[model samples]
Target: MKITHYLYNAFLIESGDKKLAVDPGGLMFYYFRFSPLIPKSEWNNVTHIFVTHGDPDHYWHADRMAAVSKAPVICNKTMVQEIDGKYLLLGPRDKGVAFTTEFKNHHKLSVDETIEVDGVTITGIKTTHGPLTVKLGPFSKTLNPGRDERIGWGAIGFKIQLDGKTLVNLGDTLLHKDEWESIDSPDVLMIPIGGNAVHNTMDIPEALQAIRIMKPKLVIPCHYNCPAFFSKNFNHADEDEFRNELEAMDIQYAILHKGDSIHV
Candidate 1:
C-alpha cells in the first residue's frame, strides 16, 4: 500500500484501485489559504473518506468528496452529528450549523467500533480532543484552558488495516489516560505534535511519550503549520525536534512534504 500526504491531516491511501482519503481540508475558514493537493480526478475515485474530527482543516471538502466517490464517510458518531447538526452540541458555539447534508453513504461509529470497507477493516479508537476554552475577563477578552477532558462526544482515532499492514491516524488530540496503551502497534502512526498554551494538541515531549507507549514501526506527525489567521491558537511545533528524538530513540520516522508518498 502507498500513502500520500496532502497537508495538515489529509492523507490518501491506496492499495491497488482502492483509495481512501482521510481529513481532506477545505479553504482556510472560508478563506483560500489551502487549495487541493490531489486532483479532482484522483479524489473522485476515493473509495472511502475517513474524518478524525470536524475541524474545518480536517473535514472541509468531505461532503463533496463523498458525493463524488459514492463512498461512506466513516467517522466517530460526533462527526456524523456535525454533518447534520444533529443536536447543535458542537464546539464552543451551542448554536447549530446553518445547513446540513444527508450524505446517504455516511457511517457513524463510536469508540471501539469496527467497520469493514471493501476488503479493509477500520477500527475506531478512543481519542480526546484538545482542552476546552474558558472565557476570561469582560467580552471574552482573555481565555483560560480547562481540564483535559476526553471528548466524550466528538472525536476519534482510527486503526486501519490494509494489505496486511496497520496504520493509525490520531486526529487532533492531547495525551489521554491509558488511551495510547489500548492501540496495538501499527506499521505507521500519524500523530499531532503542534501544541502550546493557545492550543490543545500534543507537544514534542508528549508525542515522544506516546511513541514510547505505542511503539509503532514508524511515525508521522500532523496537525501543524496551520495559518495563524485561520485561528490565533492554531499552532505548530518544530518537527526537527521530533525527528531528532526519534533518531535518538532508534525509531524509524518520516516527515512528508505535501504530495509526498511512502510505501510499506
Candidate 2:
C-alpha cells in the first residue's frame, strides 16, 4: 500500500484497485487564489472520499471532487439531513450551518458504526474538535463547537481496513483517551499535532499520549506548520522534537511535507 500526503489532513491511500481520498480540502484564507490540496490532476481517479468534519480546511472541495470522480463520500451522520426524501449534505460553500449541498452518492455513519463500501471496511471513531480561536491584527474570535456553530461540526475519525491492513486517520481532534481505547495496533496512524498554538487539534504532547494508546506501527503527524490568514505557519509545531521523543519511545514515525508519500 502507498500513502500520499497533500498537506493539512488531505491524503491519498492506494492499494490494489482502490484509491481513497481523505479530506480533500482546499487552502483556506486565500480567497483571491484557489489552491486544492489533493490537486486537480488526481481527482478523476479517486475511488472514495472521506471527511472528518465540515471545516473549510478539511471539506472545502469535497463536493467538487466527489462530483468529478463520481466517488462516494463517507462522513459522520450529522453532516447530512434527510429531508423530503433527499439527503442533503452540509453545504460545502454555504454561509453557515446549512444543508444546501447534496451528493448523489454518500454514506453517513455515527461514531462506533461500521460500514462496507466497494470491498473496503470502514469504522467511524469518536473525536472532538476543540474550539478554534482566530486572530487578525488586534481582534480575535473564538468559535466553539455546538449545535448551531461550525467550528468542529461532524467531527469523527476513520478506521479503514483494506488489503489486509488497518489504517487510522484522526481528523483534527483533541485527545479522547477513553473513547479510542478499542483501536489497537493499526498499520498506520495519521494524527494532528499543531493544536498547541491554536487549540483546535491535539498538540504534540497529546498526540504522543494517543500513540501510546493506539500503538500504531507507523505514525504520520499532520495539521502542523500550515498556511492560514497572513501567516505561513499558522499552526506551528516542532516536528524534530516530536521525532526525538518518538524515537526514545521506540515508535516509528514519518514527517511528511506537502506532496510527500510513504509506502507500507
Candidate 3:
C-alpha cells in the first residue's frame, strides 16, 4: 500500500486497484494559499473521496475533485447536506464566499457504520471536535458552554481496511478513551497533533497519549503547520516535538511534508 500526504489532513491512499483520497479541501488560505500540494492532474486517478467534517479547510476541493474524477464523496450527513447539489460559497461566516462551478453526489456515513466503495472498506468512528468558541471582531464568546455544543458538526474518524491492511484517520478530535475499544489496532494511524491546548483539537501531549492507546504500527502526524490568513503570525505545532515524544514511547512514526509519499 502507498500513502501520500497532501498537506494538512488531505491524503491519498493507493493499494492494488483502489485509490482513496481523504479530506481533499485545499483551496482556502487557512490551509494553503494558491495551489494544492498535489496538482489537479494527479487527482484524476482517485476512485473515492472521504471527508471527515464540514470545515472549509477539509471540504474545499472535494466537489471539484469529485466532478473531474466522478468519484463518490463520503462525508458526514451535515456536510453532505451543505454541498449536496448547490455551489459552495467560500469565505467568512455571513459574508458569503466564493462558489464552485460543479456539483457531485455525496454519501453520508454515520458513526459505527461500514461501507464498501471501490474495493475499500470504510468504517466511521466517533470523534469530538472540542469545545465550541467563536470570535467576533474584538469580542469572543463561548457558544457551546457546559453541554450545549456537540463537537464540531458531529465529527467522525475513519477506519479504512484495504488490501489486508487497516488504516485509521482521526479527523480533528480530542483524545477520547472510548474510541480505543471501538477500533481495532491499525497498521497505520493518522492523527491530529495540534489544537489540544486551544480547545479545538488534540495537542501534542494528548496525541501522544492517543498513540499509546491505539498502538498502531505506524503513526503519521497531521492537521498542523499550515498557513493562516486571518492572523498576522502563522502558528504551527512542532512535529519534531511529537517525534521526540513518540520515540520515548518506542512508537514508530513518519513525518511527511506536503506532497510526500510513502509505501508500506
Clashing pairs in 3: 90-97, 90-98, 196-203
User: Can you write out model 2's per-residue Cα lDDT over 83-135, one digit (the tens) per residue?
Assistant: 88889999987768999888999999989999999999999999999998889
- Error at 80, model 1, angstroms: 3.2
Would you list the rank order by TM-score, best first? 2, 1, 3
Q: What clash count does candidate 1 reach?
A: 0
Worst 10 residues of 3 by lDDT: 89-98
Give the Å error, residue 206, model 3. 0.8
Question: Model 2 residue 184 lDDT?
Answer: 98
- Mind giving the per-residue lDDT tens digits that candidate 1 earns over 1-264? 888886667889898878989986654442346455355777778998888876556766777677788887787776444444443222321223322456767677788889887787998888776653423334332222222222323578899998888999988788874967877678999988876553557878888888899999989887676543435334557778789999999999988867788887
Query: TM-scores of all models?
Result: 0.82, 0.98, 0.81
Ranking by lDDT: 2, 3, 1
Best model number under lDDT: 2
Model 3 — TM-score against the truth?
A: 0.81
* Model 1 CA lDDT for position 156: 86
Best by TM-score: 2
